[model samples]
Target: MSTADTTDNAVRELLLVMPRLVGRVKRLPLPEQLRSLDLAPRHLSMLSLLLLDGPLTVSQLAGMLGVAPTTVSLIVSDLSRKGVLVRREDDADRRRRIIDISPDSRPAIAQWLSPGARAWRHALAPLSPAQQRIFVDTLLRYEAAVSTPTRTAPRRG
Candidate 1:
């Protein structure tokens, strides 16, 4: 097969598999504490970052999340109110607040999120650092393409 054919085949397989993969992830059980908070995708992203990177400031989270500081603050505030997150003074910078998962809620959040993390580790373990970078970059490009709006051609009668 030509290179074009190979690329098209890979794309076709990904299109078929992506939805099922997302569906399985969505079906993962939410812990009882989190279930009542009415969490959204944004919340999941924030929580995942904290779980992986430890505590971070609102500006740092906003930069990573591609959102404004106010937006991150709102999310932090809401999660804090729900007992899922905590904000404390940053030791290095007395004025800055560091956000992290609350001790009370950490286990539940870990329980809910760890399975997916482990699955990713398993899938990526065999890859060399370069291969992992390529894989991550490809997914980032795919996300950008899907997120951008496109105009469709007009139809004729």
Candidate 2:
């Protein structure tokens, strides 16, 4: 096959395998500390964001998660009810509420995501520094591509 054809085939294989790999990762049982929380990936994702970015407003989270403010509010409510999240008035704008992952949750959240982290580390351990850098670079580029919103053509009449 031509180089272009070979590259296309490689891309097709990656596209097919990525989701299955993620599904397998997602199927791993939650650590006991996080089990009772009944968290979904979306929940974990928001909490993870908070853990990474500190407190954020509902609108800010909605923007990050690509959902509506009301949707994020519902998510915040559920996490709050479970004691995994805390909502506080923004110091500069009392009218705005900022949602933060409870400090108490940091340990559990870290433990919950640890399995995947370990798996990735194990998989990368044998790679040379150059290979590791290329792998990370590719992933960063892929993330950027997926995060960018594409303009869609209007439906035909």
Instruction: Please list the residue runs of candidate 2 whose C-alpha ends up more than 4 Å from where it truly belongs after superposition.
Output: 1-4, 114-157
lDDT of 2 by residue, 1-157 (tens): 9999999999999999999998997787776767787787789778767866888999999999889999999999998988888999999999999998788877777777767667878989999999999999999899999999999999999
Give the TM-score (vs. native) of candidate 1.
Answer: 0.95
Taken over the whole model, the C-alpha lDDT of each candidate is: 0.96, 0.87
lDDT of candidate model 1 versus the reference? 0.96
Which lDDT tens digits does candidate 1 get at residues 1-157? 9999999999999999999999999999999877889999999999999999999999999999999999999999999999899999999999999999999999999999999999999999999999999999999999999999999999999
In TM-score terms, which candidate is top?
Answer: 1
TM-score of each: 0.95, 0.67
For the record, the alpha-carbon RMSD of candidate 2 to the native fold, in angstroms, is 6.0
